[model samples]
Target chain A: EPEVTQTPSHQVTQMGQEVILRCVPISNHLYFYWYRQILGQKVEFLVSFYNNEISEKSEIFDDQFSVERPDGSNFTLKIRSTKLEDSAMYFCASSRRTGSPLHFGNGTRLTVT
Target chain B: AQTVTQSQPEMSVQEAETVTLSCTYDTSESDYYLFWYKQPPSRQMILVIRQEAYKQQNATENRFSVNFQKAAKSFSLKISDSQLGDAAMYFCALSTGANSKLTFGKGITLSVRP
Candidate 1:
């Protein structure tokens, strides 16, 4: 079955640095999302993208977080400045329609020192 | 606000026996969707099963099935004839409608005993 694919399975960065996480959603999917899970915590919604723009975002998805559909198949999340608390597993997901079953990527583990 | 809760943090069952994971959600919307997802050591989230709020019939996929109680706002997952490969962290999620964002529970870890 088609699936969401994320690049850089694991990343390590220093505090105040920048990091870019990339994802290639299912080719036919129309809605895309970015979520994060801190160790031993529940998954938190970051942002949702549709029609090539952001639909909704949570407070955790603040000014530092930005998502872009750079191309027809590539969706990317960029963090302007990283902090120690930014360490977590970031998952990219896509669905044929909004709120439908979302297929998730293996996740990119971001570790900030 | 909508919240999904997985009451049990961990559970164990024999390889061939059955096990149930509990989940409860609070949502004001009448129509929504419930989902069960599994994450193994690789941490790849995989869809195990799904249930639509409007449907009364329970959803079953292979040995994985759901006990959905719409009135009580509870959705539980039952794994029958469990296999060793069933060991993983299970998350319960709720979505208000088609094409909506999902709210996930903290997840429960399940271990299948030999």
Candidate 2:
């Protein structure tokens, strides 16, 4: 089955650095999302993207975070400045339609020192 | 706000046996979706089963099935004849509607002993 693909399975960066996480959603999917899981916490929603615009975002998605569908297939999340608290596993997901079962990637583990 | 809770943090089952993972959710919306996802050591989130709140009939996929109690706000996953491969971290998640964000439970770890 087709699935979401995320690059750089593991990312390591110093505090105050900028990081961009990339994802290639399923070819036919229309809705995209970004979620994060702290080491021992529940998976939290970060943002949802549709039609090249953000549909909704959780409080965790603040001014430092931005998502862009630079092209038809690639969706990217950029963090202007990283902090130690930003360390987590970031998952990219997509769905054919609203409320459809979402397909997720293996996830990119971001580690900030 | 919608919240999903997985009461048990860990559970184990013998191979060929059956096990159930409990999940409870609180939601105000009448129409929504509930999902169970399995994440093995690789941490790849895999969809195990899904239930639509509007449908009374439970959702099943092969050996994976769900007992969805809409009125009770409970959705549990049952794994029958479990195999070693079934061992993984299972999560209960909810989405209010289309294009909405998912709220996930903390997740429960399942171990299938051989």
Candidate 3:
């Protein structure tokens, strides 16, 4: 089956540095999302995008966080400044439309020291 | 706001046996979808099964089935004839009636023994 794909399976960065996690969602999917899972914590939603604009976002998606679908095929989440708390497994998910089941990528493990 | 709870942090079952993971949620919306996902050592999130709140009949997919009590706000996953491959962390997730931004539970680690 076709699946979502993420780049840089693992990312290691220092505090204050920036990082961009990339994802290539299923070719036919229209809705995209970014979620994070702190070690030993539940996955939390970060933001959702459709039609190149953000539709919904969680409180955790603050000023330092931004998402861009710079191209037709790539969805990227950029963290302007990293903190130790920002270290987690970032997941990219996509669905055909609202109310549909999301298909997730293996995830990008971001580690900030 | 909606919250998902997985009370059992860990569970164990012998190979070829059965095990059930429990989940509960708090949501005022009458329409929603519930899902069970498995995360293994690779940390890949795999969809196990899903249930629509409006459906009255429990859903079964091969060895995986769900006991969904809509009124009680309870949804449980039962894995029958468990195999060692079933040992992984299972998460329960909920999405709004019309959206797919999933709210997930803390997760339950299942261990299948020989």
Give Cα distance to truth, residue B73, candidate 2, Å: 0.5
Index of the highest-DockQ prediction: 2
Please provide, for model 1 over B1-114, each residue's C-alpha lDDT reduced to its tens digit, 9 standing for 90 to 100.
889998899999999999999999999988889999999978889999989898999999999999999889999999999999999999999987444899999999999999
**lDDT tens digits by residue: candidate 3, A1-113:** 99999999999999999999999999999999999999888899999998889989999999999999998999999999999999999999999987788999999999999
State the DockQ of every prediction: 0.74, 0.86, 0.77
The CAPRI classification for model 1 reads as: medium
User: What docking grade does candidate 3 earn?
Assistant: medium
Report clash pairs, candidate 3: none
The parts of candidate 1 lying over 4 Å away from their true place are B97-99
Q: Which lDDT tens digits does candidate 3 get at residues B53-105?
A: 88999988899999999989999999999999999999999999444789999
Model 1 alpha-carbon miss at residue A49, Å: 0.4
Give model 3's clash tally.
0
Better of 1 and 3 by DockQ: 3
Q: Indicate the fraction of true inter-chain contacts that candidate 2 also forms.
A: 0.96
lDDT of 2 at A96: 89
